[model samples]
Target: MEKIKLLLTQYQEAILYIVFGGLTMLVNIIAFWLAFQAWHMNSSVSYLFAWFWSIFFAYLTNRTWVFHSTAHDLKTVINEIFQFLVARIATAVIGFVIFYFGVNLLKQDAQIWNIIQNIFVIISNFALSKLVIFKKKA
Candidate 1:
């Protein structure tokens, strides 16, 4: 029991990050499905729409829960938001490329490619958040 508690305490941040990240992915999947399947939007448009929502959700949850960001000042908060968006935008572009090539060029299933691209995005986003956007100040 003590060992389990200690491990959980040590890795709580990572565990919370995965939990929030999974929720963010659910948002993305639902958004994409609605746009693509229900609204009959183009693949690229649906993907971009989903990206927007997921990023919005990710920013909120990641700042509040995952990293416990402490930037209270207006300037610092703005800076963090800007940095987070930039990092997400970079990942979005990479995800788009993967989706495009995998689904469009390679004739793979869109659903499969979406999952694949998101896995990549989640890993990269975690790295960016930990190393750059929400790095703890010394």
Candidate 2:
């Protein structure tokens, strides 16, 4: 128990972030698949829907647990959400570009492209959250 506690104390933020990020990815992929395959939605539209859901989930988890944001007041909460959205939007553009090139231009499979895009987004998002969106205020 003591060893586990010590390990968690040492790497709580990272471990939680990874676990939540993975959940977010799962949400995105499942949503995308449902919209694209089951619902027969347009590819880009499905991707957008998945993006919206995943971002919302990510924000909730990140604010509540991963970064432990202390946005008590309305202004601070709005600012933090704005920052988080901006960072996510930046990554969204990257993902979209990759999807566009891989699917439309190269005629690659959507599933394969989505997997690749998520891999990049996950890595980039962790950096963005740590360095910019969720950086502890000095």
> Which candidate's TM-score is highest?
1
- Each model's TM-score? 0.75, 0.72
lDDT of 2 at 66: 91
How does residue 58 of candidate 2 score in lDDT?
A: 93
Scored by lDDT, model 1 comes in at 0.93
Q: In model 2, which runs have C-alpha deviations exceeding 4 angstroms? A: 92-120
Model 1 spans with C-alpha error above 4 angstroms? 92-120
Candidate 2: the clashing residue pairs are: none
Show the colliding residue pairs in model 1. none
Q: What is the lDDT of residue 2 in candidate 1?
A: 100
Candidate 2 local lDDT, 33-94, one digit each (tens): 99999999999999999989999999999989998876789998888889889988888789
lDDT of every predicted structure (CA atoms)? 0.93, 0.89
Q: Model 1 Cα displacement at 90 (Å)? A: 2.4
Candidate 1, residue 58: Cα displacement in angstroms equals 0.7
